[model samples]
Target: MTTAAMPATPADPGAAEAADVTGRLDALDDMLRLGGGRLDPRLLDEAGALLDRAGERLRLSGEHTVVTLAGGTGSGKSTLFNAICGLELSPTGLRRPMTSKAHACVWGLDGAGPLLDWLDVDKRHRYARASALDTARSDTSLQGLVLLDLPDHDSIRAEHRAEADRFVTIADLLVWVVDPQKYADAALHRDYIVPFARYAGVTLIVLNQVDRLQPEEVDDCVADLRRLLQAEGLADPRIVTASAASPDGVLGFREVLVDTVAARRARAQRITTDLDRLAERFAGQSGADEPPAGVPAPARAALVEELTDAAGAPAVAEAMESAYELRAADFVGWPVASLADRLRSDPLRRMRLGELREELRNAFTGPVGAQQGDVDNALAAVAETVTGTLPPPWARAVRAAARRHAGELPEDLGEALKDALPTFNQVPRWWWLIKTWQYFLVLATALCVLWIGLLVAYGVFGAGGDGANGLIGDAGLIPYVAVLAVCTLGMGYLTNLACRNMVALQSANHGERMERHMLDSIERVAEAKVLKPIADELAVYAQFRKDAAALRG
Candidate 1:
């Protein structure tokens, strides 16, 4: 994933190693960001410590390596520390715990002052291995080494043992001292070796006081100790037999230190091992592959549909259709019929749907309706669908994300649906034309009836013998009037039928359109309040798994 070209064969191997370490650290930063709270808190803390230690170590000095000397109380640990430092910096006597605190003997202190401070080594206990005059030529090979002597791990005082444990955790290379008598101490193997088995590469075990044994028996003791260490999960454990009393007793162990220092890789190796163990712990809590892409489409659709029903969309849509039909009839129906319609309540108004948007402004604050359970079930289904394929912890995270904004869902849906409903304020031009024509027909029928009645009145009063014939040029006013009345009324009836048919079609279309808009609104609310959060969490997991796999590698 790095675009920067690295040398096919690096001139300096340390540079390449440094670049590799930087890349790993960067990947670890990503892992911490993506998987921080979702993973176990203890594991997260370990990762954070590793990052901080790596950063501080790299900043202090790459030239110096911090190697800790650790062992049980009678393991000759202080004696070995003095032997390595070539000075009696740590007291060695019959004292129960000779080194109650940590002491540092730093070589090449050119820039190691801050490092010692970072390690919290007391000034009184600090010593210099190489002087300014360069007089200690024999110690030149061990330059750039910051050797630490820690308190006895098996000390009677809990504080002493705790101090030893703390140094062991932060040391770049651990030199464990054990006497022949307590080489197989269970506390040593269980408390330290087995728990830090991943640190085998950066660890060294020194078997002190081998001079107490027969020369021939020393090899047998070393071999047996090696066997025990290997059994405790350290493959090919490094063991050295030495004595603090003999001048040349630790020559072989000193040579191992020389090689470790010349390599200048112990610090990076320690941090890498820490990262590897942490990666393994993370892998245990997650699946090998990434989780599924997201909640399936059908599941999302089902959720939206459920929400639509719970929001009363269907009822509102049906009311919209009935309301449209009633209003259309009032606009285009015959005059007498229009007046009758005014007496009947508007269907939407009767259902209180006209005020629905306003009423819903305060609704769904709690379980206020019969459909609230449906909403809850739908939300649960969405959460399950998103998290079903995830590992337990990650699944829990995803489920939590889904429900984080659940309480706001109802109000969001109400707002969306309120915006979705159409205002039925506009009327079609054809309705006005039909209404005018129906009123015209009604007026013509009324006039025709009046004319027929007036002609009859005149003939009955005997003032005119041919009053009926006088009308419409002798075609007979009665017959003409009768025909005009029937034609007008019949046309009115036919027009009403056509208008009713068109209103029915229009009403059905309006109902279908409203249903679609409401459904769309429900989907938007679902996406904003539910599905988006779930998707965001899945994205986090996907990236976390990637970074974790890189760490494992």
Candidate 2:
């Protein structure tokens, strides 16, 4: 037997709607976090209030929908409210102004007490539609409805108007009751309709007390009101005409309410509409999205170069080269010349580079102050490169990130240079070998000079004596001794020439190596302190844009 799989259970729209609301809230929070310092403060506060209001509303029963009746004096708002509830719930009179406190008539009051409390309606003013005494179940279609009768919107008392405005904002559905006489009042259109154009989907424009108008006049008035609403940017506004004094006074409104309550979307729709409006406001402040490409290679290199110069890298490297040459001179110079070389100071030592750590710290504190301008320029250049395509606010954020840790920049560069410079204490084997050869040549030259001096003395003091005869055989050898002394000195001179050539080659290599090390060290510092921060700011902007887009959606 073939068994058919049951159709997948349809998704619970309520759960999905709740999840969507949650996602939007999360996105709004992210936008706030990323944009707190960059965006307008007042707008952020409004967004925060919306978040709190939405959360509080969600915490209450999503099953119930709050519908508010708002209208100016003599609009028969309370009469229409009583008619909808099928009872005299809210007081109606010919007085100039009506109730200041709102009255709530709730249907299916199970799980609705907390919601009513949240609305802050006085308990004495609250009424229930679905009681045990009602056996006919006539209000079944209006179950889960929290109907509120608010004070007249144009009440003379400021507190009453304020109270009406507060409830109007949080209500899921708004039934704006207007009699034909005051339907075109500027206060109604300006303060309520024009400002709430975005909420037209949940709004109802009821032309109440229309019994006074002829049927043709009612059509014309409704048509004129519709034109006014459309001009005010409300799209396809829903308009119903009724007379609270008639037997079937609010039948049309009841039908709309039943459909609205059954759909169970008014609450979600209300908050979502609020979020949509807020998201659009936020979007106005944010510009086009520019993906973060990080710091450009040229910018990075330029920053390193600037910092390397500020840290005195070139000077130190040159000093290292000169110091090598000086040491070579001391090791390979002729004995007397080597003593003179010792009298000259070592180049690196003259710069106080032997105590690298302390010297650099002091230099950065003092001499390095002159290079602060260069450092600032380099940072600005990098920030400009990174933020060139960003919006003004985000660009400012990126620039601020670049300079946030700038005070530490000079010291950081100094430390990098300190670690890069080589210690000159290590002597190459070739230097030692060349020094030993020079020592041997010096000893030979000294012996040859001594031989020539002795020969000269004997010839002068004992020319005809036995010593002279003994020395006579060596008389011709004096010239040879003299030549030998001259040859030994020339050989010593050649050794000195070779040592100079070798020191020159090694010194050049040493300088180049030192410069390379300095560059590498500077690159690392630039990446850690400057480039990384810029990239982080860009990332924040990118993420914020994504979240804000979600909110807009």
Candidate 3:
């Protein structure tokens, strides 16, 4: 038995529709890659395989729509197949199953070989109406159609059934041939018809052995079959009653086939149905009706605060303040007082601020044990806040993304702190002027004291008391020395007071600067370690949702 290929017809009406479906499939492929492991593996694989087949069909034989005749044992599928082609192509007998392998009939041989190759049908024949009888022939309507007679779906041999099922998946249209006894078979309805509910638009049901039934009972049987099909979720399915043995009985079925081929919409409808099925399977993973709003600001601030605490930023800032105050005091305080300050340890050195700065510049190296717990807790809190309202799969994905760099966060934060620490050892130019003025004051005080000592020595050690007393009283030097010494000491004291006040002001300014730097560092760490990952996951989710909606459409 041989079958013919569809004839070349006018421009394909399904080109635009096919393009739309192809674009949607491409979007779905991108979404699957973006979603990573978040989507169900099995569903993804099934969708991927179906898409490949659809793409291959569209590329190889888009101009031809392939329809298959599938049915159970003793259903006369082959007989109907031959009757439709108007030739003795497929053999028929009382055998349990007539056709074991699929046979193809193409109306127009152009561009049909590749499609037949994809369908794995080797036996093929071409049939074209002669130009002389074109006006009388109705078969011209089925110009670009490829008709196949598949092995019985209920064949006793497992391979025959498998072959039939394989062809059913690839065919653009399916025509189920049922005899009177098996029109409502439980296995057929439950396993085949129910599962293909999405393909109802491209499916046709035929009662192939209706000639055996009483004339009065035909209508009742047809009505009952319609109800059963509708119950199986096929609404208003096309049902035709025919007998391949009677030429007139098969005419109605042939007319329907002709119309289907003429419309050229079956291929597009089949692909659209497949896409819808995939969309439905993945709908559960897309949470809520719409994409979520961005993460809250307060939550972000809180996360930064937590990270700062974890990184010991406050401790470092306080140390900066103390170090600045100590250095300032040593620079401007009275010589005597500053000596005591210098004897104590420098706060910045004790904290190793200089070494930390060098380390930050060269490479990140610092211990973060003090605030590691705080950092982890902060990260967890931020992840929870971002994913709290998401569906389970998406929520988990977001949480995982947040912790993608968990092990590196502590080290990164420590390096950030090192960078934030302020330099306190720098000397200002004003200190030099202040030091010179203090030196002059010391000199004046020392000169005054030395002059007073010489006067006292002259008074105590003079050869005669009368002379010394006379000279001292004559010069009035006693009060002169006393006033000079008092004035110089008072001036030096005032100078020390003024310098102390200036140093205090400078320390306050430096403290504020250091605080700002520390906060900025904390914000950066929060952005890199916690916030970026959450954003990435949300991006993938958004794309997934968009693609799913397109496929649904």
For all candidates in order, the CA lDDT equals 0.81, 0.82, 0.76
TM-score to native of every candidate shown: 0.89, 0.89, 0.85
- lDDT: which candidate is best? 2
Look at candidate 1 and tell me the lDDT of residue 256. Answer: 85
The total number of steric clashes, by the backbone 3 Å criterion, in model 3 comes to 14
Of 2 and 3, the candidate ahead on TM-score is 2
TM-score of 3: 0.85
Q: Write the per-residue lDDT of candidate 2 for residues 369-484, one digit (tens) a residue.
A: 31567778889988988776787888888999999878878777877777776555677888888788888877887887776666666665544455454444355668887788
Q: How far is candidate 3 from the true structure (C-alpha RMSD, Å)?
A: 5.3
What's the distance in Å from true for residue 106, model 3? 1.5
Off by over 4 Å in 1: 1-13, 131-140, 338-370, 459-469, 472-475
Q: What tens-digit string does per-residue lDDT give for candidate 1 at 1-553? A: 1335434534433555666777778778898888777888887888888888887877777788899999988898888889988888999899788788899998788999999999988899999977442354444378788999999898899999888988898898999999989999999999999998779999999999998999888989999998888888997888888898888898888888877876788888887887778777787766866587778899999888888888888887787787777678767777765556557855655455445434443343444432556677887888897676678989889888878876766667766666776665677889999989999999999998887776666645544555444563333467878998999989998899999998999889988998999888788888888888888989888888777777776
TM-score of model 1 relative to the true fold?
0.89
Score candidate 1 by lDDT. 0.81
lDDT per residue (tens digit) for residues 1-553 in model 3: 1133444543676878888888888877876786668867887788888878888887886767899999988888888988877777887889777787887888777788777778778644334332232245555466777888888887899999999999888888999999888899988998899999778888999998888999988999999999999998997889999997776888788778778877788888888888888887887877765544445789889988887777767766665666665565555556644545458866765456456444434433445533567767877898888786677888888888878877788888877777876444457888877777777776787787776666666655553455565544333575687798778767767878887777777767766777678778878877876787788788888888887777777
Which regions of candidate 3 are displaced past 4 Å?
A: 1-10, 123-136, 339-370, 443-451, 462-498
The 10-residue segment with the lowest total lDDT in model 3: 125-134
